[model samples]
Target chain A: MLEHVVNGLVLGGTYALVAMGLTIQYGIARIMNLSFGDTIIAACFATYVLFSVFAINPILALLIVGPTGYVFNLLIYRFIMKPLVARAPDEGALEVDSILVTFGLLFVIQGVLLVMFGGGYTSYSFLNSPVSMLGTVVAGNRLVALVLSLTFGAVLVGVLYRTRWGMILRAVATAPQSAPLFGIDTNRAARTAFAVGGALAATGGGVVSMFQTFTATAGVVFTMKALIVVILGGKGSVPGAIVAGLLLGLVETFVAAYIDPGLTLAAVYTVFLVLLLVRPNGLFGKA
Target chain B: MTMKTSHAFLLAAAVLALLAAAPLLIPDYWTGVLLGMTGYVTLATAWAMFSGPTRYVSLATVAFFGVGAYTVAVLNETLPYPLVLLCAGGIGMVMALIVGFSTLRLAGVYFVIFTFGLAELVRQTVSWWEVNITYTMGRYVFLPFEGRHIYWQLLALAAATFLISWGIGRSRIGLALKALGDDETVAAHAGVDVTRIKLLLFVISSTIITLVGAIQAPRWTYIEPSIVFNPTVSFMTLIMALLGGAMRLWGPLVGAIPLFLLFEWLSVSFPDHFSIILGLLFILIVFVMPEGVLAKIETLRKGSPK
Candidate 1:
């Protein structure tokens, strides 16, 4: 149905937004960042509190949450991730170390959140009114979220593709060994990219809070979903994230609507497995 | 055997004999706690057997484990206990073979996530089937296993896991795996059958994990997808193995006993803050001793010349 299509796009938009952040971190910074979802969930809870207690609009909360995410991620990079980065014998060692470290970080953030928020599902009504679009009625907040997601995605793509800073980042990501030869501060680029990715995750969380119910423990679900999108989109490609995110959303929506709803997760994994088996490098990934 | 080897063997036999008699000497409450410790020790030891040398860091420990638990849960009533255990092992082996062949080619982050995804996929599929076909959320495990019986079973399994790990470390496959872990392409060039060694080790590790799950399932009384397929099991096994020094045969045992005790104490004293403490410990462990406690000890010993 047309309604399902609209819903899928809204879901896919958030997926793309989060996947972009993760791709940026993994592709450029070379940190697997299992805690990325906890950051997103933290932003969601932050937006919730701001909206409920301070009476700030969710859109306005983005201004506060996004920068906090950037700063928090930067601090984590400086404090926690720096040592692992320093002693890594090779890229493979770094990957293993990052995965273990971030996996620990995931529990740390989740534990703090659980302590602060009593392990309950939290959602607040925001822009609940439905608006007619095309031949279908859609929630006002989801539509706004989609538009915001697209706008952010577009701006990021433009920055990455059309700017010198983006060029340096791309060069570092593609060839870390040779980036130093070109006078690019690969370390600085990696830190900034990781922080920016955190900002995007926070922004995505704010967008999601407008329409979704979330729990402190649900961060892993978002992490897994974003991971799937990132890998499917080709690890570091922004445009690929957009396409793959939307594709996953559509597939999930369609499977839920046409088949049994309980099979949605299974369906997503099926698509991911088949794609991985077929193209280990992903659709747009470089070998 | 060498004199030192025979001495080590005698020491091990004496310790195991003491452990076998522990249940009769200890109170019922402590027997329960020891049972939990043995279970984790078995799982952790099996996990390190493959992950340590290969550096593959599999997160699918629960996948095979859950399969083993589910197999027993379904077949226990129809079949005898030993038969159910055999079936569980058989099913786990087949699944491991399928998963290993398909996925051993991918390494690093890709393999890690793939195993994780595979576990989640199995969990979701089982959950769906239970809801739609079985019309039940969980199954009752009515095995007549006492605390001591399960503990002894797990203890035996843990011993077997250690023996297998020790044997493998001395085998040609172990050397090949070590080479592959250092660099896959070079190992391949050096005529190591990279895929076969990986598959063999992976299957062995996974089958042991499956048996552990089967042995431990009776203690739960009720089993479900959420309980059996909990990702925490995977994470905990990885942490314990790595914390002890996965590369060493006895490292998992060294890691599991202390961490298990710490967790038990944390949960009892500060139930609400248990997760927070756990997280901090994990972070501290990885940050301070990424190579693990044994490795840290080795460095200290080297620094302090005897």
Candidate 2:
């Protein structure tokens, strides 16, 4: 049971990082990139190659993978999102169009990765040793991941909440119409947020690849997982997303441990679906 | 603002007639491709009818499609195909009713997520039931129809879907939906039955999709949770709808041909890389013609200055 909690936290941390990135993108940028999963998967594959093939440490590979992801997402924002941002007259239209755009982008990225990697499962040989902790054994990579996820989550929350840049960002997110009145470079800020979201997502993905095996085809499931986290945590709340991610990771871990593996995802999502009817905003969500 | 339903009907009839005879006209290998295209055309057109009007992006393709497939999978031995089709449609309608009522009140993103999570629920349930009760990985299916018959059947399904979409595109309900899509609160204040319209359209679209899944299920030698409840198939249907442009009734059809052909060719030639190329195409579409091909054409025709 204690072991499940530890594992859940590790899973939760990963979920929080991924969902936090999504939350930032959606809450502030007013655009939800459905390709968040593919972005993670892309980073994971990159990590797999760097760590497994090139004999680099997975942590070190984050330096290479994270920036690449940031640039890639910035390009996505520039070419794809920027055009739509101008084209859509209202927030709702932008949401609808951006979802489609990201769906299209997901396929494109998945296709490229599938071509390059051939959809084979790849892994990073990292942190093989297990540490004994309170009658439960945890892998070295997962321990690193928990600390890293917490650290990054703190860094993001700190930046978003405690910093001056975060103040301008929050202004743009809450009232884009008035942000311009206040002389905030709303577009540039949004682009920067997206880049940051990408970097965070890649870092989380590299960590996850260190712990679990993944493939290009893993994109959709991961995407859904991230969506579940964000929804469970609330759409735009960073702390909410983090807490929700942890809750989901716990729920999933317990269910997997206690029930049939095949029944795990079905049970979790069905319950979440029903729960949505009662508290549509999620547990820690503003509503 | 555009063509009347009657005119669209006449145009559709001509196209359907040509499509009905397409197996004879096209090369033999392409018959399989044409058949698949019709399947996508059916799903995409119907999907657009519901989602396009409200601007609600539903990711629940497999949920409706699986209803029909699962209905047949479980009951094909006991029930006739016609009965199975009815039950499939009814099941899909009920599912949509339940899902819509629960989700329609939530924000737009909630709807998308719920629709997506729905497939996960259904797939896992079916697979679990299959393993525990059905005692099999998949069920063998034997439909008393040749390849061409199935081809025509799929074509007829596409034609029917197109007709319904065309009818809906011109109807008062369609106008209300477009109003709602433009601004839900205004539409509600304007006395449009927002929830009812969304629910009705959702049920209607899902029923047609359910029927298509049932019709297509028999062509497979074996049926399982994976094939019937394939999310990729659902997403591709949605993407194709967008790729064609969901605003107009005929947009998805316009989008279906190239997408289906490319999908078939790539899956056959470079199975792994085709999705990448398709994705590239999708991106190009969004970049070059975000409104869809038909919209792009209209812009060109009007010589609209950006």
Candidate 3:
């Protein structure tokens, strides 16, 4: 049980990272950003290519890929998101159009990746070391992922709470109409959020590559998990995403260990469904 | 009736006639492809009928399709084909009702996510149980069928789908669904019984999709969790429905034939790049013609004012 708990926490940390990225985009930009998964996959592939061709250490590759993800996301926002947001005259219509456009991006990215890389699983060994935790042997890669995730989360929380840019972002998220009056460039804020969100997602993907074999199509499953985390945590709620991510990780780990591995997704989704039914606003979300 | 409306009907009739006679003109492989396209049409139409007009996006269509496919596959081992097909559809309707009741309360993107999560849950459960139970059962049970039979089965299913869509298009429920799509809160306040109407449409649409799957499983001569429960199917169907003009009764059938043909062509020409092309097409359709090719044509026609 303790082992499961530890495992769950570690996994939850990874989920929290992904969820944080999703929360930023969903909260500030108000776009579903379905292509979030594509960024993750791209980061994974970038890491893979770096390792395969140059024999670069996975840790260094992650550092490089993470920033690439940020730039890619900025491009997506400028090319795809900015146009959609500008065109949509109302909130409801905006939501629909955003879903369609982001979903379109998801498809295009996944398809291009599949063509370029073929549907084959690839993985990288990062740690080559193992650590004992709670009377169980745990991977050093997972430990690295957990530490990085927590650090990233703390930095994000700090940035959101302490920084002027973060305050501007919050202002935009809360009241878009007032932001312009304050001379805040709302478009720049959105672009920054998208880039940061992408970086975080790529970092998560980099961590994932160290632990699991991945293919071009793996993004779909990752996207589903991120979606579940976001829903469970409450859309646009950062702290809520963190809490939900950890809880989901725990649930998935325990389910996989004791019940059945295949049912892990079912278990997570069941909890999400129940949560949506009972508290649509999420556990920590403001009504 | 207006001459314009009559012309549309005439065009539809001609298309139906062509579909009915397609097997005679096409090669055997092409005939099979057309049959597969018909199945996609049925699934796409059913999805559009419920979600498109009601403005409720469901990622669970593939789950319903899988349920129908599995039901038919399991039942056919012991029962007649027609009976299996009916039961498959019934199973799909029951599942849809349960899912709809549970998730329809959430609004907008919440509904989309919940439905998607539910579909994932179904998929995981199916994957877990499929191998063990099906393998054990395979020892004692089996079904016999040929490819050509699938053509007729799919054709009949397509006709039934068209009739259902036509019926819904002309029904009070259809009008209410449209209203709900336009504005859910207003429709609810106007005594639409929004939940009940949505649930009813969900059941009907899911059932039709399952019926299509029931026929399709035997036609393919195999069924698997991943293939039947693929989210790509749901996504592609959404694209097709949108591309043909959502809320248009015959849009899916019109959209799917050409889309499937394009898919086939792409797969043949560049197998690895097929998904890339399809994805690009999806993006193009949304960006360039959000209302769809047919809707664009209709708008132009209206602007011309004959």
Q: Residues A1-287, candidate 3: write the lDDT tens digits.
A: 88788879889988889888988888788788777887888888888888888999778887898898888888888888788888887777777777777777777788888877887887877785989876888889888878888888899888988999889888887787889899999888878987888999998888778777898877766777888788777776778788889999999999999988878887877787688778877887767
Residues B57-168, candidate 1: write the lDDT tens digits: 8889999989999888888899999999999999899988977877787766767776766677788898899898989888989988899999999889888887888788
**Considering only chain B, what TM-score does candidate 3 achieve?**
0.88
* Reference-based lDDT, residue B59, model 2: 86
Candidate 2 lDDT over A1-287, as tens digits, reads 99999999999899899889888888778887888998999899889888768989888898998888789889989988998999887888798878877887888888788878885777756887999987999999999989989998999899989999999888886778899998899999999888888887898889899898898877777778888877777777788889988888888888889887677777567666777877887777665
Ten-residue stretch with the least lDDT total in model 3 chain B: B133-142
Q: What is the lDDT of residue A95 in candidate 3?
A: 74
**Every candidate's TM-score, chain A alone:** 0.98, 0.96, 0.95
| TM agreement with the true structure for every prediction | 0.97, 0.92, 0.93
Query: Could you give the TM-score of chain B for each candidate, in order?
Result: 0.95, 0.92, 0.88
TM-score of chain A of 1: 0.98
**lDDT of prediction 2:** 0.82
- Give the CA lDDT, 0 to 100, for residue A95 in model 1: 87
- Model 1 chain B is weakest, by summed lDDT over 10 consecutive residues, at B1-10
Candidate 2's DockQ: 0.61
Candidates 2 and 3 compared: the better one by TM-score is 3
